[model samples]
Target: MPVPTTRDKNPASILIEADKCSGCGLCVNVCKDFGLEIVNNKVHQSDKALFGCIACGHCMMVCPTDVIAIEGRTLSPVLMFELPEKSQAADYESLLAMFKRRRSIREFKNKAVEKEKIEKILEAAQTAPMGIPPSDVHVLVLENKKQVRLFAEDFSNYLKGLRWMSSRWFLALIRPFLKKENNEMMHDFVKPLFDVYVDDMDKGNNWINYDAPLAMYFYGSPYADPADPIIAATYAMLAGESLGLGTCMLGAVHPFIQNGKKASAFRERWGIKYPSREGLVVIFGYPAVHYQKGVKRTFAHIHRVS
Candidate 1:
């Protein structure tokens, strides 16, 4: 009787061609799960793997002879492609210039963003790295100003029900239970933010989404790493910048819509899959104003162990 491989039990599959394998040990060395080993002077799947094949494609991507192939679990060997020439890529100076050019644009022209540009931004963001093999990031796209305003209105109404969360009595009651930093943040930043959003909305001003022509909300599932959606949103922002679009990341919406029955219903209405640990809303449109200069930015502290 033959032993059942990981693929036999799961959807992930791997293929290795003995003739093409150079046995250079690159695949074996890079297989962190110990799924590959040298057997009979050739690279072969090892039975003593830690957790079986994860379909991460490390072996297939590293193999110079193209002897390995991985498929299933939303991945395939056909997805592999040759990287661009190194000389065509951006150098440090050019990359830094692009980074410095990015600004959080709030004032937008009264115009619509073309659907093709939005699609291109999404295409570029799709290349962002994920914490796992299959990405769990979800995006809610409000393609027009009306849709964005409608969402903002719905969110504002939802916030009314949870107003007590920011009340002084509520803060006093929860301060003892919360961590020191959390309690301080609740009193100092979160409470004021809630007030500003709700109050501004009541006065007929849409402070939530800023009436941008295109708004994208990136979120993650319960099992996802918190940084996954954030990184994806950042990528989308940069892609939008490259296409001559103004972009601003809205960080306030995610936390307010994360808990309670009302929040759940709001998420269901928008088709958000999970209460993500971290999320971001990026708004895109043509710029209405331009700045002549940008200020330098730096971290508050940096330390080197050496």
Candidate 2:
């Protein structure tokens, strides 16, 4: 059986150069799917594979000899590159410092983000794990403040039609079905958000995306794990910070741009491919405001259970 993903339905084809095989069993040992084995002093495809070759390419990546190659399912030898030296990677302390320095910046300078920075942000985001091979995450890049504002305005207009969802009667109707926290969130948070995002936009204030210089919408297909786009968005946000660009994740857009014919039409206008269960939009630019101090944050709970 092959692992199903949005990109491909079939398992990757493994090509073994039996004549070049050293019978070292290196590929066999590393094949977590049990897709390879050595028999009669030659490496061969195994019959007892757990899920055939899902094409993680671990066997090819670890092989000392270039005897195994994976083809199809978005796997290619050309995609391989030399790993960066461990010493060149960010240390824990430096990474922690970067994390601490980052603040959710909404107000931004009018200057545009450089194209090179945008490209590098995408490059780093591509390295994020997607819970599956050949990540299904797709990104829509709005490269300038004008484009971002346009999208924000369009989204605000869209939200105008959805205002009824935040009405008192609607909240009262749904309160009994939702958890206490969700009910409170819908009432105290989301309702006011609806007012500000739409009404402010009507008054020529772009509260939706804050008119940032750059924006990226990371989303996934139906077959994608819901966390895929969220993880990619986080990576992009961190990449923006590393590139000296302020960043903020806009949560209101994705949920609204899903379901119903109107939402589908809006997505089509913006070139979005599919309705993802989870998605995020991150706006980037030079920050208008700077913080002198870092805020300490903690998780609600941390547990270690035996």
Candidate 3:
């Protein structure tokens, strides 16, 4: 027979016999070169991996039955198992430009976010690098506006109950200033966007949470030595941004949920018990107002060591 043209070396040809394949679809997912596809519930060749497969063998390894085989002609292609195309990624200057352009969004649209889009964002949260293995971080998805209102009332009362634990004079002294002061601190810790949101709610209307059609609460065990919900929440927030959704972190709400009565009711209704670890709440929705652009930044100096 003539020299097999398949002998050209990158990923030359993939010989897959369907009869031997269990139709696991693992190969379809593992092939990074866009070299495989599943049709009629079976896997088949989609593209020649000659320039693509990189000969990493991910497909062959994950294959349970050892049916798939990859043939190569030349040097193997580089595998991207650790990170995504960092070699081709932008330089430090370019990244600083992107960070400078980042902005905090306020004012969400009246539109409802699609369930599938929410699911995609959550998938990124699931993929976040965990500090330890086998940690259970729970997500509570609230899509109903009515329920959001209920939670807000419950949340407000929860704060009130905590206030009740103090002296009456102290409560009286702080009552008038609580909303004003809480709003300001909220603006500082969470986001400046909450300044407007809290103002609207103070006007006897549950406006902010009302505006957000979606919210997710994340929680983990409190018994752990170091609670890392905030770290995980940070991942979820970035993941949400990557998926083209607007997110505002609500650091203030965790206190109410963990210790307040209104919070207890909300938790009981949802059948969520306190994790012996850490917890967080993340709110997301389409922005009613697009951020015009990122604001100016404060300067920081970096020290480099040779």
The C-alpha lDDT values of all candidates are 0.87, 0.92, 0.60
Ranking by TM-score, best first?
A: 2, 1, 3
TM-score of each predicted structure versus truth: 0.93, 0.95, 0.55
Order of quality (lDDT):
2, 1, 3
* Model 3 poorest ten-residue lDDT run: 1-10
Model 2 steric clash pairs:
none
Report the C-alpha displacement of residue 131, candidate 2, in angstroms.
1.5
Q: Tens digit of lDDT per residue, candidate 3, span 50-104?
A: 3455444667667777666766643222321345587887698966664554444
Q: For candidate 2, write residues 1-306 as lDDT tens digits.
A: 887887898989999999998899989998889888899989999899998788888889888889999987898999998999999999999999999999999999989898899999999999998676878999999999889989988888888888999999999999889999999999998999999998888899988888999999999999898999999999999999999999999888899888999999999999999999999999999999999998688999999899
TM-score (C-alpha, index-matched) for candidate 1: 0.93
lDDT of 2: 0.92
Give the per-residue Cα lDDT of candidate 3 at 231. 64
What is the per-residue lDDT of model 1 for residues 1-306, given as tens digits with 9 covering 90 to 100? Answer: 112221233536778898878889999988887888987778998887876676678889999999999877667988988989999988999888888998999889999999999999999888888876567788999999999999999999888888898999999999889999999999998898788789999998888999999999999887777898999999999999989999999999999889888899999999887898999999999999997899998999999898
Q: In candidate 2, which residue ranges exceed 4 Å CA deviation?
A: none
Best by lDDT: 2
lDDT of 1: 0.87
